[model samples]
Target: MPQTENQTQVTDRPQATKTAILVIGGAEDKVHGKEILQTFWQCAGGTDAIIGIIPSASREPALIGERYYRIFADMGAKEIKVLDVRDRDGGRDSAYLHYVENCTGIFMTGGDQLRLCGLLADTPLMNLVVERVRAQEIALAGTSAGAAVMGHQMIAGGSSGECPNRALVDLAMGLGIIPEVLVDQHFHNRNRLARLLSAISAHSDLLGVGIDEDTCAMFDSDRNLQVLGRGTVTIVDARDISYTNQNQVHGADPISIHNLKLHVLRYGDRYNLEGHQVIASS
Candidate 1:
């Protein structure tokens, strides 16, 4: 049975039977991002899987022209189709609907998530995606902006490295493929720790994951997270803590944070999300 959005939340799903969700940082292509894509393919059961590419997030749809699709074809995907959800109609095109209905694995290209959500939110196509993922018949993978939308709370930052306060950052409910954890991409490369940390600090109940560029984090059915790629994924936990006068701290305020454990995960490393602890070594 397909899990209703309200019935079994992403975080509360029985780990023994959940599907895998892949979140990739930026720079995806054959030249540099091939490994991320290849790993995703392998996890999705290889060439036999149906793959759908949603390029709707791109600023200019033409930028993701034929070359991108060719790469997936070469990788042996049974079929490949691009969903132009950026349109005013929100990828309501017949071709887009057909592809989403048949795909076993959906890949959201790195681009502007606001644009992607603006076009797809509340649309029939978006509903289908939610349905597919709930059924666990398909895997949802997104890079950059695409990756940002997997969580219930998404980071829509105005500047590259600006840390946001509770109301400063624009956050909207995401597709709900993963819950509790707020994801930020281009971590180390973009120096986004402060922003991510601030987000966690603001919402102490939520977990913060900062994935480095060219890296991928795989969260399996049981909410077990694995990190892959050349770089690292930083997990920031502020679940229990005590703080005072953060707003009053002067030049380089020395704020003390206790009970916060920071874990740097590399390729092949795994962690249990519920327990908020690492399970395997890198």
Candidate 2:
């Protein structure tokens, strides 16, 4: 028997210093202004930042890892290390774990979400990263596929350019860094609003956060999610959804959902994850 309406939520928080998690949509501005990466650099301690890059999600780990390495190096980071772990065994390598332990910031590059999880999930390295982030020992940031893996309930794959339906999206367990939400990257650019809406219709308990390209949903230690970038962040709140036919709907059948709250936020706008309140940009 499955639990439908009463799924137990994970309640865990960092009790130490303030923490920040930057979830960036795909194709961030890396050459020109570099605002998003700059913000991440500042959050991670600016010039004193000891950064670690996880390029495991990418097919060309060396290439992707070096690209970020050059980016951070050019940004005047104190130290930057690329941890290109390809297999489960690499996750346990003491050297990589040592760098992660000492790192002030960790960045996961964009690539294959499923491949990323398949390589690192439940491993000692992944567990350590989660533990450190929760303890406020490190600032975490992920782009694209990396962003998709920030939530406990992740959208692994889905079809776009369609109405909300049961088969519009595929869900998977993510890193659980932010367990109460589901993240979708390259949002509007890929026309994934319906995909996210379909996902929320099924699991109405989780907040569906859809981030547009180059944008970021920056979640602080206090659970205040702030929008930053050139585009908007769409929040789908179904906590008070009056009706949804997800349970009754089968594959590809359109689902009906009512009373769902939608918020489209831009730069400097904030949303409290704990209370589900929106704070408009001044």
Candidate 3:
């Protein structure tokens, strides 16, 4: 079972980082070809891109690190690097920081989202990485657990069901790369709409996006979002929400809200991140 939240305290400080949040839902199609990764490779300068894979979130760091190593190498990534930070010390290491700082693109691999946040959050290496991204010097991407940490407010743990309730979800602070959004990966397969709605109810100002497996939701700095992959991406807009019982209710009591908007998009579809308005793109 995935841990809900770690002992690490959640803080409200906002990160000024800006970059396209290339979030892939779990189980990307990697073995057959670079269907999903090709997009990342292209954004990373194609053949000239120096890519680094961060596998610190994984339990099997070596294997997970090597997995992307082989994949990116096969796809002609200029250089592939791995930052397997096993502990906070490794995260603070100058050698590891050097590798992360030089990359054209850095990707966080899947496993435990909390594990990734715990190791890198507020570390010297993280500061460097955040600095580069804030300067628009590099691209950043992640899948699964990696994808979950890109938002300012994230869903740390929750139960998936059709019913909406306050108790169905847990919230935690995230990297804030994609500010004002709460991201949920493995969405459609897990039937996570209810929990996602519950999360938005807690903070109605933030947008909620639920990405399905093998899918990627790419966000540019202006917060323009595009969908890619074999499954649908669901958008939950609570900004216009007129009502909610999140504060008035307790426990598993059913939740009610008015004017909560939802949108389901497929590959090649586009939408605006700021307003949750669909963009007419071909």
Candidate 4:
């Protein structure tokens, strides 16, 4: 039987001050164990978690949002509500912004990353979300398109399943939740390595994160990254890359880069952004 939205109760307790964000690669296995959603629920606030779901990125907001509402309810969320940030005006409305006060966590559903950012970026809603996250008032989780928008610089559009090419990829400003990093979802299934490699060529200072299907990378305010779920997370480290024709290259041509370090971590693996170390589980 499907759980009703009423199952969640509002909590009056003081909010916890530990900010966290979850970046899911997309197509999470919801039925078998619901591992990702369950983890998100616990991290958000467990029984006291009141999740504010934003479906603005999706073309079919209401129709697509029902799945998450029911899933969160079954997972014991104190309250779950879907928001419609379909336009710039809606994002600025004070009435809609009130949802953030009662929320312990905010979940952004997968869809078109551009649409999500386009409508909310630089708006009051996004400002509030970021403020709450930094204050540790709530945690944020997003899958697929939601995951893509988590970085400071995002891959707006690109060609996949090919050798690295700089011109074919288009980069854009993201919501900037995760600093000094770029996130790409559905990595393994989509064969996005080439594109991600090229993306790093453009922004040598950023770490390129490739997350696999049904997998996730959780980042804490301390900048510690942990891998979870059934799949893996690939890290494209360009910090040590000696050289690249990326800057000089023009048109749709193969990019040449050297000494780009790659790290592939599976479930339970951890990474420290400040220390730039991989803390693998034994």
The lDDT values for all models are 0.72, 0.87, 0.80, 0.84
Which number leads on TM-score?
Answer: 2
> Can you write out model 4's per-residue Cα lDDT over 1-282, one digit (the tens) per residue?
112121122122112224678899999877867777777888888888989899888999997688899899988889888887788998888766888876889999999999999999999888899888878779899999888998899988787867898766788889998868899888989888988988999898999999999888988777778877778899999988999999787777889989988889876678889988998754
lDDT of 2 by residue, 1-282 (tens): 111111122122111223689999989888876777877887778899999999999999999999999999999999999988999998898998988888899999999999899999998888999999999888999999999999998999999877999788999989999999999999999999999999888889999999999888999988899877788899999999999989998998888999999999877788999889998765
lDDT of 1 by residue, 24-78 (tens): 8776545643767776665555787677778877886656735557777888878
Best by lDDT: 2
lDDT, model 3, position 95: 82
For every model in order, what is the number of clashing pairs? Answer: 2, 0, 0, 1
Instruction: Residues 33-73, candidate 3: write the lDDT tens digits.
Output: 44567778777777888888889889998999999998888
* Model 1 Cα shift for residue 235 (angstroms): 0.6
Clash pairs (backbone) in predicted model 3: none
Candidate 3: deviation at residue 24, Å?
A: 0.9
Rank the models by TM-score, top first: 2, 4, 3, 1
Give me the runs in candidate 3 sitting further than 4 Å from their true place. Answer: 1-19
| Runs of candidate 2 exceeding 4 Å displacement | 1-18
